[model samples]
Target chain A: MKIKVLAFGKIADILPQQEWEMDGVVTTGMLRGQLEAKYPDLKGLRYLIAVDKKIANDDSPLEDRSEVALLPPFSGG
Target chain B: MEKQTVNTEEKPSHRRKKVFVEGPISPAFVGDSIAKHSTMMNIGAHSIFLGQVRKDVIEGQEVVAIEYSAYTEMAEEKFHEIREDTFAKYPLTCMHIYHSLGKVDAGEICLFVFTSAIHRREAIDACNEVVERIKQEVPVWGKEIFDNDQYVWKENK
Candidate 1:
Protein backbone atom coordinates (compact mmCIF):
# COMPACT_ATOMS: atom_id res chain seq x y z
CA MET A 1 0.00 0.00 0.00
CA LYS A 2 1.07 3.54 -0.72
CA ILE A 3 -0.07 6.67 1.13
CA LYS A 4 0.04 10.31 0.04
CA VAL A 5 1.43 12.78 2.54
CA LEU A 6 1.16 16.58 2.92
CA ALA A 7 3.44 18.51 5.21
CA PHE A 8 2.79 21.88 6.87
CA GLY A 9 4.52 24.48 9.12
CA LYS A 10 7.91 23.53 10.55
CA ILE A 11 7.32 19.96 9.53
CA ALA A 12 7.19 21.01 5.87
CA ASP A 13 10.53 22.76 6.19
CA ILE A 14 12.10 19.72 7.84
CA LEU A 15 10.78 17.32 5.24
CA PRO A 16 12.60 17.23 1.91
CA GLN A 17 9.35 17.41 -0.01
CA GLN A 18 5.90 18.80 0.79
CA GLU A 19 3.90 16.14 -1.02
CA TRP A 20 5.23 12.64 -1.43
CA GLU A 21 4.42 8.97 -1.05
CA MET A 22 5.43 6.03 1.11
CA ASP A 23 4.91 2.38 0.37
CA GLY A 24 4.04 -0.52 2.70
CA VAL A 25 2.34 1.76 5.24
CA VAL A 26 -1.04 0.62 6.58
CA THR A 27 -1.65 2.68 9.70
CA THR A 28 -0.98 6.13 11.12
CA GLY A 29 1.40 4.75 13.74
CA MET A 30 3.45 2.93 11.14
CA LEU A 31 3.71 6.03 9.01
CA ARG A 32 4.84 8.04 12.02
CA GLY A 33 7.54 5.49 12.74
CA GLN A 34 8.66 5.39 9.12
CA LEU A 35 8.76 9.19 8.85
CA GLU A 36 10.68 9.68 12.10
CA ALA A 37 13.13 6.94 11.14
CA LYS A 38 13.72 8.22 7.61
CA TYR A 39 13.82 11.91 8.61
CA PRO A 40 15.51 12.07 11.97
CA ASP A 41 15.01 15.84 12.10
CA LEU A 42 11.27 15.24 12.30
CA LYS A 43 11.77 13.62 15.70
CA GLY A 44 12.50 17.04 17.18
CA LEU A 45 9.22 18.47 15.96
CA ARG A 46 5.79 17.96 17.54
CA TYR A 47 2.91 17.25 15.17
CA LEU A 48 -0.20 15.21 14.46
CA ILE A 49 -1.57 13.16 11.58
CA ALA A 50 -4.80 13.99 9.78
CA VAL A 51 -6.03 11.14 7.60
CA ASP A 52 -8.55 11.78 4.85
CA LYS A 53 -9.65 15.14 6.34
CA LYS A 54 -9.98 14.20 10.01
CA ILE A 55 -7.59 13.91 12.98
CA ALA A 56 -6.06 10.45 13.17
CA ASN A 57 -5.28 8.43 16.26
CA ASP A 58 -1.99 6.59 16.65
CA ASP A 59 -3.45 3.27 15.58
CA SER A 60 -5.83 4.65 12.99
CA PRO A 61 -6.11 2.31 10.02
CA LEU A 62 -5.30 3.98 6.72
CA GLU A 63 -6.58 3.45 3.21
CA ASP A 64 -4.07 2.95 0.43
CA ARG A 65 -5.26 6.08 -1.39
CA SER A 66 -6.00 8.28 1.59
CA GLU A 67 -4.33 11.67 1.90
CA VAL A 68 -2.36 12.18 5.10
CA ALA A 69 -1.21 15.53 6.39
CA LEU A 70 1.45 16.32 9.00
CA LEU A 71 0.11 19.28 10.96
CA PRO A 72 1.80 21.24 13.71
CA PRO A 73 -0.09 23.21 16.35
CA PHE A 74 -2.80 25.48 14.94
CA SER A 75 -2.52 29.30 14.77
CA GLY A 76 -5.68 30.22 12.90
CA GLY A 77 -8.43 32.63 14.09
CA MET B 1 -12.18 37.08 -10.44
CA GLU B 2 -15.78 38.21 -10.58
CA LYS B 3 -17.68 38.48 -7.33
CA GLN B 4 -19.49 35.30 -6.40
CA THR B 5 -22.89 35.23 -4.76
CA VAL B 6 -23.56 33.34 -1.56
CA ASN B 7 -25.34 30.13 -2.54
CA THR B 8 -26.37 28.78 0.84
CA GLU B 9 -28.93 26.49 -0.79
CA GLU B 10 -26.26 24.31 -2.38
CA LYS B 11 -24.94 22.54 0.70
CA PRO B 12 -26.85 20.25 3.02
CA SER B 13 -26.66 20.86 6.77
CA HIS B 14 -24.25 17.97 7.24
CA ARG B 15 -21.91 18.97 4.41
CA ARG B 16 -18.98 21.25 5.06
CA LYS B 17 -18.68 24.63 3.37
CA LYS B 18 -15.57 26.39 2.11
CA VAL B 19 -14.07 29.12 4.32
CA PHE B 20 -10.70 29.84 2.75
CA VAL B 21 -9.46 32.81 0.74
CA GLU B 22 -6.28 32.79 -1.36
CA GLY B 23 -4.41 35.55 0.51
CA PRO B 24 -5.54 38.43 2.72
CA ILE B 25 -9.18 39.16 3.37
CA SER B 26 -9.63 42.66 1.97
CA PRO B 27 -11.53 45.50 3.70
CA ALA B 28 -13.60 46.17 0.60
CA PHE B 29 -14.76 42.58 0.50
CA VAL B 30 -15.85 42.69 4.11
CA GLY B 31 -17.55 46.03 3.64
CA ASP B 32 -19.41 44.65 0.66
CA SER B 33 -20.62 41.78 2.77
CA ILE B 34 -21.93 44.20 5.34
CA ALA B 35 -23.73 46.18 2.67
CA LYS B 36 -25.35 43.04 1.33
CA HIS B 37 -26.60 42.00 4.74
CA SER B 38 -28.51 45.26 5.09
CA THR B 39 -31.35 43.66 3.21
CA MET B 40 -31.99 41.10 5.96
CA MET B 41 -34.52 42.93 8.10
CA ASN B 42 -34.64 40.25 10.79
CA ILE B 43 -30.99 40.64 11.68
CA GLY B 44 -30.79 43.52 14.15
CA ALA B 45 -27.26 43.12 15.35
CA HIS B 46 -24.02 42.07 13.62
CA SER B 47 -20.78 41.34 15.44
CA ILE B 48 -17.55 40.73 13.58
CA PHE B 49 -14.05 39.57 14.47
CA LEU B 50 -11.14 40.48 12.22
CA GLY B 51 -7.69 39.02 12.83
CA GLN B 52 -4.82 41.09 11.53
CA VAL B 53 -1.22 40.01 11.10
CA ARG B 54 0.90 41.96 13.56
CA LYS B 55 4.50 43.00 13.17
CA ASP B 56 6.19 41.91 16.35
CA VAL B 57 9.85 42.21 17.21
CA ILE B 58 11.05 38.82 18.32
CA GLU B 59 14.68 38.51 19.46
CA GLY B 60 15.51 41.75 17.62
CA GLN B 61 13.97 40.57 14.35
CA GLU B 62 10.87 42.35 13.08
CA VAL B 63 8.17 40.13 11.65
CA VAL B 64 7.13 41.15 8.13
CA ALA B 65 4.62 38.58 6.96
CA ILE B 66 2.97 35.28 7.74
CA GLU B 67 2.57 32.31 5.44
CA TYR B 68 -0.40 30.22 6.39
CA SER B 69 -0.99 26.57 5.56
CA ALA B 70 -3.43 23.96 6.72
CA TYR B 71 -4.56 20.37 6.75
CA THR B 72 -7.08 21.65 4.24
CA GLU B 73 -9.86 19.10 4.48
CA MET B 74 -9.71 18.79 8.22
CA ALA B 75 -9.82 22.55 8.70
CA GLU B 76 -12.94 22.77 6.58
CA GLU B 77 -14.60 20.06 8.62
CA LYS B 78 -13.67 21.80 11.82
CA PHE B 79 -15.04 25.10 10.58
CA HIS B 80 -18.32 23.44 9.71
CA GLU B 81 -18.56 21.85 13.11
CA ILE B 82 -17.92 25.19 14.79
CA ARG B 83 -20.60 26.84 12.67
CA GLU B 84 -23.13 24.19 13.62
CA ASP B 85 -22.18 24.36 17.28
CA THR B 86 -22.47 28.17 17.34
CA PHE B 87 -25.91 28.07 15.72
CA ALA B 88 -27.12 25.51 18.23
CA LYS B 89 -25.84 27.50 21.18
CA TYR B 90 -26.83 31.02 20.09
CA PRO B 91 -29.75 32.59 18.30
CA LEU B 92 -27.76 33.66 15.27
CA THR B 93 -29.49 34.62 12.07
CA CYS B 94 -26.43 33.90 9.93
CA MET B 95 -22.70 33.33 10.16
CA HIS B 96 -19.66 33.64 7.92
CA ILE B 97 -16.15 32.53 8.64
CA TYR B 98 -13.15 33.19 6.39
CA HIS B 99 -9.44 32.56 6.83
CA SER B 100 -6.48 33.42 4.68
CA LEU B 101 -4.10 30.95 3.08
CA GLY B 102 -0.65 31.73 1.57
CA LYS B 103 1.32 34.89 2.38
CA VAL B 104 -0.23 37.87 4.14
CA ASP B 105 1.86 40.84 5.16
CA ALA B 106 1.76 42.63 8.47
CA GLY B 107 -1.28 44.94 8.93
CA GLU B 108 -3.38 42.84 6.57
CA ILE B 109 -6.46 40.94 7.59
CA CYS B 110 -5.98 37.21 8.04
CA LEU B 111 -9.25 36.03 9.53
CA PHE B 112 -12.80 37.36 9.20
CA VAL B 113 -15.65 36.06 11.35
CA PHE B 114 -19.12 37.59 11.00
CA THR B 115 -22.23 36.58 12.93
CA SER B 116 -25.62 38.20 12.78
CA ALA B 117 -28.43 37.92 15.27
CA ILE B 118 -31.60 39.61 16.48
CA HIS B 119 -29.88 40.95 19.60
CA ARG B 120 -26.48 42.37 20.48
CA ARG B 121 -25.57 39.86 23.17
CA GLU B 122 -26.23 36.83 21.03
CA ALA B 123 -24.29 38.26 18.09
CA ILE B 124 -21.29 39.27 20.21
CA ASP B 125 -21.09 36.03 22.16
CA ALA B 126 -21.37 33.83 19.09
CA CYS B 127 -18.68 35.81 17.28
CA ASN B 128 -16.28 35.51 20.24
CA GLU B 129 -16.95 31.80 20.65
CA VAL B 130 -16.48 31.11 16.94
CA VAL B 131 -13.17 32.97 16.86
CA GLU B 132 -11.82 31.09 19.86
CA ARG B 133 -13.04 27.75 18.53
CA ILE B 134 -11.27 28.32 15.22
CA LYS B 135 -8.00 29.34 16.87
CA GLN B 136 -8.05 26.27 19.12
CA GLU B 137 -9.59 23.55 16.96
CA VAL B 138 -8.73 24.26 13.31
CA PRO B 139 -5.69 22.53 11.84
CA VAL B 140 -4.16 25.63 10.26
CA TRP B 141 -0.57 26.74 10.80
CA GLY B 142 1.30 30.01 10.33
CA LYS B 143 4.96 30.65 9.60
CA GLU B 144 6.22 34.00 10.83
CA ILE B 145 8.51 35.47 8.20
CA PHE B 146 10.82 38.03 9.72
CA ASP B 147 13.25 40.60 8.38
CA ASN B 148 15.99 39.36 6.03
CA ASP B 149 14.17 36.12 5.33
CA GLN B 150 14.44 34.76 8.89
CA TYR B 151 11.36 32.86 10.05
CA VAL B 152 9.70 31.31 13.07
CA TRP B 153 6.66 29.15 13.74
CA LYS B 154 3.68 31.08 15.17
CA GLU B 155 1.67 29.56 17.99
CA ASN B 156 -1.64 31.27 18.82
CA LYS B 157 -2.23 32.05 22.48
Candidate 2:
Protein backbone atom coordinates (compact mmCIF):
# COMPACT_ATOMS: atom_id res chain seq x y z
CA MET A 1 0.00 0.00 0.00
CA LYS A 2 1.10 3.56 -0.68
CA ILE A 3 1.56 6.01 2.23
CA LYS A 4 1.58 9.79 2.46
CA VAL A 5 4.57 11.08 4.41
CA LEU A 6 4.77 14.68 5.64
CA ALA A 7 7.90 16.16 7.14
CA PHE A 8 8.20 19.09 9.57
CA GLY A 9 10.82 21.08 11.54
CA LYS A 10 14.40 20.20 10.66
CA ILE A 11 13.24 17.00 9.05
CA ALA A 12 11.79 19.14 6.27
CA ASP A 13 15.27 20.48 5.59
CA ILE A 14 15.97 16.97 4.30
CA LEU A 15 12.68 15.73 2.78
CA PRO A 16 11.65 19.35 1.93
CA GLN A 17 8.20 18.66 0.50
CA GLN A 18 6.36 15.37 0.89
CA GLU A 19 3.23 13.45 0.09
CA TRP A 20 6.03 11.05 -0.67
CA GLU A 21 4.88 7.66 -1.81
CA MET A 22 6.61 4.67 -0.31
CA ASP A 23 5.50 1.46 -1.95
CA GLY A 24 4.64 -1.86 -0.17
CA VAL A 25 5.31 -0.56 3.33
CA VAL A 26 3.28 -2.65 5.78
CA THR A 27 4.22 -1.12 9.13
CA THR A 28 5.62 2.06 10.64
CA GLY A 29 8.97 0.32 11.14
CA MET A 30 9.19 -0.56 7.45
CA LEU A 31 8.32 3.01 6.47
CA ARG A 32 10.93 4.33 8.91
CA GLY A 33 13.57 2.11 7.39
CA GLN A 34 12.69 3.22 3.88
CA LEU A 35 12.78 6.90 4.89
CA GLU A 36 16.04 6.56 6.81
CA ALA A 37 17.59 4.79 3.86
CA LYS A 38 16.38 7.34 1.31
CA TYR A 39 17.36 10.36 3.36
CA PRO A 40 20.40 9.58 5.49
CA ASP A 41 20.09 13.01 7.17
CA LEU A 42 16.95 11.66 8.85
CA LYS A 43 19.11 9.09 10.63
CA GLY A 44 20.58 11.69 13.00
CA LEU A 45 17.37 13.58 13.70
CA ARG A 46 15.24 12.79 16.75
CA TYR A 47 11.56 12.70 15.86
CA LEU A 48 8.30 10.76 16.11
CA ILE A 49 5.83 9.42 13.59
CA ALA A 50 2.17 10.35 13.43
CA VAL A 51 -0.15 8.01 11.59
CA ASP A 52 -3.30 9.68 10.32
CA LYS A 53 -2.79 12.73 12.58
CA LYS A 54 -2.17 10.78 15.78
CA ILE A 55 1.20 9.87 17.36
CA ALA A 56 2.18 6.28 16.75
CA ASN A 57 3.67 5.59 20.17
CA ASP A 58 3.11 1.89 19.69
CA ASP A 59 3.39 -0.26 16.55
CA SER A 60 0.25 1.35 15.16
CA PRO A 61 -1.30 -0.11 12.03
CA LEU A 62 -1.20 1.86 8.81
CA GLU A 63 -3.62 1.32 5.96
CA ASP A 64 -3.47 2.37 2.33
CA ARG A 65 -3.11 6.13 1.80
CA SER A 66 -2.22 6.70 5.43
CA GLU A 67 -1.16 10.28 6.15
CA VAL A 68 2.06 10.13 8.13
CA ALA A 69 3.83 13.09 9.71
CA LEU A 70 7.39 13.21 10.99
CA LEU A 71 7.20 15.53 14.00
CA PRO A 72 10.10 16.79 16.08
CA PRO A 73 9.95 18.09 19.65
CA PHE A 74 7.27 20.73 20.19
CA SER A 75 8.43 24.21 21.19
CA GLY A 76 5.13 26.09 21.21
CA GLY A 77 4.02 28.12 24.24
CA MET B 1 -11.29 37.80 17.15
CA GLU B 2 -14.59 36.70 15.65
CA LYS B 3 -12.88 33.96 13.70
CA GLN B 4 -11.27 32.69 16.88
CA THR B 5 -14.56 32.66 18.78
CA VAL B 6 -16.30 30.77 16.00
CA ASN B 7 -13.75 27.97 16.07
CA THR B 8 -13.78 27.67 19.87
CA GLU B 9 -17.40 26.67 20.40
CA GLU B 10 -17.02 23.62 22.61
CA LYS B 11 -20.48 22.32 21.80
CA PRO B 12 -20.08 18.55 21.41
CA SER B 13 -16.69 18.49 23.21
CA HIS B 14 -15.00 16.91 20.17
CA ARG B 15 -15.04 20.00 17.98
CA ARG B 16 -11.60 21.41 17.23
CA LYS B 17 -10.48 25.04 17.72
CA LYS B 18 -8.34 27.20 15.46
CA VAL B 19 -5.28 27.97 17.56
CA PHE B 20 -2.89 29.29 14.90
CA VAL B 21 -2.45 32.98 14.22
CA GLU B 22 -0.43 34.11 11.23
CA GLY B 23 2.79 35.88 12.23
CA PRO B 24 3.04 37.67 15.58
CA ILE B 25 -0.07 38.27 17.68
CA SER B 26 -0.72 42.00 17.81
CA PRO B 27 -1.49 43.90 21.03
CA ALA B 28 -4.68 45.24 19.43
CA PHE B 29 -5.98 41.71 19.04
CA VAL B 30 -5.17 40.89 22.63
CA GLY B 31 -6.82 44.06 23.85
CA ASP B 32 -9.92 43.36 21.78
CA SER B 33 -10.23 39.89 23.22
CA ILE B 34 -10.13 41.20 26.75
CA ALA B 35 -12.63 43.94 25.93
CA LYS B 36 -15.04 41.39 24.49
CA HIS B 37 -15.05 39.49 27.74
CA SER B 38 -16.02 42.49 29.88
CA THR B 39 -19.72 41.80 29.41
CA MET B 40 -19.46 38.33 30.89
CA MET B 41 -20.58 39.24 34.38
CA ASN B 42 -19.86 35.84 35.83
CA ILE B 43 -16.15 36.02 35.24
CA GLY B 44 -14.36 37.50 38.23
CA ALA B 45 -10.86 36.88 37.03
CA HIS B 46 -9.00 36.41 33.75
CA SER B 47 -5.47 35.11 33.71
CA ILE B 48 -3.46 35.79 30.58
CA PHE B 49 -0.12 34.37 29.51
CA LEU B 50 1.80 36.09 26.73
CA GLY B 51 4.81 34.32 25.25
CA GLN B 52 7.44 36.66 23.86
CA VAL B 53 10.13 35.44 21.51
CA ARG B 54 13.52 35.87 23.11
CA LYS B 55 16.73 37.01 21.44
CA ASP B 56 19.20 34.46 22.71
CA VAL B 57 22.85 34.47 21.77
CA ILE B 58 23.84 30.93 20.89
CA GLU B 59 27.34 29.95 19.77
CA GLY B 60 28.05 33.69 19.46
CA GLN B 61 25.14 34.09 17.06
CA GLU B 62 22.13 36.18 18.00
CA VAL B 63 18.80 34.48 17.37
CA VAL B 64 16.66 36.84 15.26
CA ALA B 65 13.36 35.07 14.88
CA ILE B 66 11.51 31.77 14.98
CA GLU B 67 9.50 30.19 12.21
CA TYR B 68 6.83 27.89 13.51
CA SER B 69 5.08 25.01 11.78
CA ALA B 70 2.75 22.24 12.80
CA TYR B 71 0.85 19.12 11.86
CA THR B 72 -2.36 21.19 11.86
CA GLU B 73 -4.78 18.29 12.07
CA MET B 74 -3.05 16.76 15.03
CA ALA B 75 -2.31 20.04 16.75
CA GLU B 76 -5.93 21.08 16.65
CA GLU B 77 -6.99 17.70 17.96
CA LYS B 78 -4.52 17.91 20.81
CA PHE B 79 -5.55 21.50 21.59
CA HIS B 80 -9.19 20.51 21.79
CA GLU B 81 -8.42 17.57 24.02
CA ILE B 82 -6.30 19.70 26.35
CA ARG B 83 -9.00 22.35 26.58
CA GLU B 84 -11.65 19.78 27.38
CA ASP B 85 -9.52 18.19 30.04
CA THR B 86 -8.82 21.58 31.60
CA PHE B 87 -12.51 22.43 31.53
CA ALA B 88 -13.23 19.23 33.37
CA LYS B 89 -10.53 19.90 35.94
CA TYR B 90 -11.36 23.54 36.62
CA PRO B 91 -14.41 25.75 36.89
CA LEU B 92 -13.45 28.05 34.02
CA THR B 93 -15.93 30.24 32.22
CA CYS B 94 -13.84 30.02 29.02
CA MET B 95 -10.31 29.70 27.73
CA HIS B 96 -8.48 30.91 24.62
CA ILE B 97 -5.15 29.87 23.12
CA TYR B 98 -3.39 31.58 20.22
CA HIS B 99 0.04 30.83 18.81
CA SER B 100 1.94 32.19 15.83
CA LEU B 101 2.14 30.11 12.66
CA GLY B 102 4.80 31.82 10.54
CA LYS B 103 7.83 33.90 11.49
CA VAL B 104 7.76 35.69 14.81
CA ASP B 105 10.63 38.05 15.48
CA ALA B 106 12.51 38.35 18.74
CA GLY B 107 10.64 40.45 21.39
CA GLU B 108 7.31 39.87 19.62
CA ILE B 109 4.42 38.09 21.19
CA CYS B 110 4.10 34.61 19.72
CA LEU B 111 1.61 32.99 22.05
CA PHE B 112 -1.36 34.14 24.13
CA VAL B 113 -3.20 31.91 26.61
CA PHE B 114 -6.19 33.36 28.44
CA THR B 115 -8.49 31.68 30.92
CA SER B 116 -11.53 33.23 32.57
CA ALA B 117 -13.28 31.99 35.66
CA ILE B 118 -15.37 33.15 38.60
CA HIS B 119 -12.33 32.90 40.86
CA ARG B 120 -8.75 34.04 40.43
CA ARG B 121 -7.13 30.77 41.50
CA GLU B 122 -8.99 28.61 38.97
CA ALA B 123 -8.31 31.04 36.15
CA ILE B 124 -4.61 31.26 36.98
CA ASP B 125 -4.20 27.48 37.33
CA ALA B 126 -6.08 26.71 34.13
CA CYS B 127 -4.01 29.18 32.13
CA ASN B 128 -0.77 27.65 33.34
CA GLU B 129 -1.98 24.09 32.80
CA VAL B 130 -3.18 24.82 29.26
CA VAL B 131 0.09 26.48 28.36
CA GLU B 132 2.09 23.57 29.79
CA ARG B 133 0.00 20.93 28.04
CA ILE B 134 0.19 22.73 24.70
CA LYS B 135 3.96 22.93 24.91
CA GLN B 136 4.38 19.24 25.69
CA GLU B 137 1.49 17.73 23.76
CA VAL B 138 1.10 19.73 20.53
CA PRO B 139 3.05 18.81 17.38
CA VAL B 140 4.04 22.42 16.62
CA TRP B 141 7.73 23.04 15.99
CA GLY B 142 9.82 26.19 16.05
CA LYS B 143 13.00 26.76 14.07
CA GLU B 144 15.22 29.45 15.51
CA ILE B 145 16.68 31.67 12.80
CA PHE B 146 19.85 33.36 13.92
CA ASP B 147 20.99 36.86 12.93
CA ASN B 148 23.93 35.22 11.17
CA ASP B 149 21.46 33.63 8.77
CA GLN B 150 21.75 30.24 10.42
CA TYR B 151 18.87 28.14 11.74
CA VAL B 152 18.40 25.57 14.48
CA TRP B 153 15.37 23.61 15.57
CA LYS B 154 14.21 24.43 19.10
CA GLU B 155 13.10 21.86 21.66
CA ASN B 156 10.83 22.30 24.65
CA LYS B 157 12.74 23.23 27.81
- The prediction achieving the highest TM-score against the true structure is 2
Candidate 2 chain B least-lDDT 10 residues: B3-12
- Among the numbered candidates, top lDDT falls to 1
Q: Estimate each model's TM-score.
A: 0.90, 0.92
Candidate 2 stretches with Cα past 4 Å from truth are: B1-15
Q: Considering summed lDDT, which 10 consecutive residues are worst modelled in model 1 chain A? A: A68-77
Ten consecutive residues with minimal summed lDDT in candidate 1 chain B? B3-12
Error of 1 at A30 (Å): 1.7
Pairs that collide, model 1:
none
Per-residue CA lDDT of candidate 1, range B1-157, in tens?
Answer: 1322343442126566668888888888888878878778888999999999999999999999998888777888899999998888998888888899989999999999998898999999999999999999899889899979989999978
RMSD, one per candidate, in order? 2.3, 2.3
Per residue, candidate 2 scores C-alpha lDDT tens digits across A1-77 of 88888888878878857557767777888778888898898888788999988889636778999988888778886
Q: Clashing pairs in model 2?
A: none
Task: Report candidate 2's fraction of native contacts.
Answer: 0.94
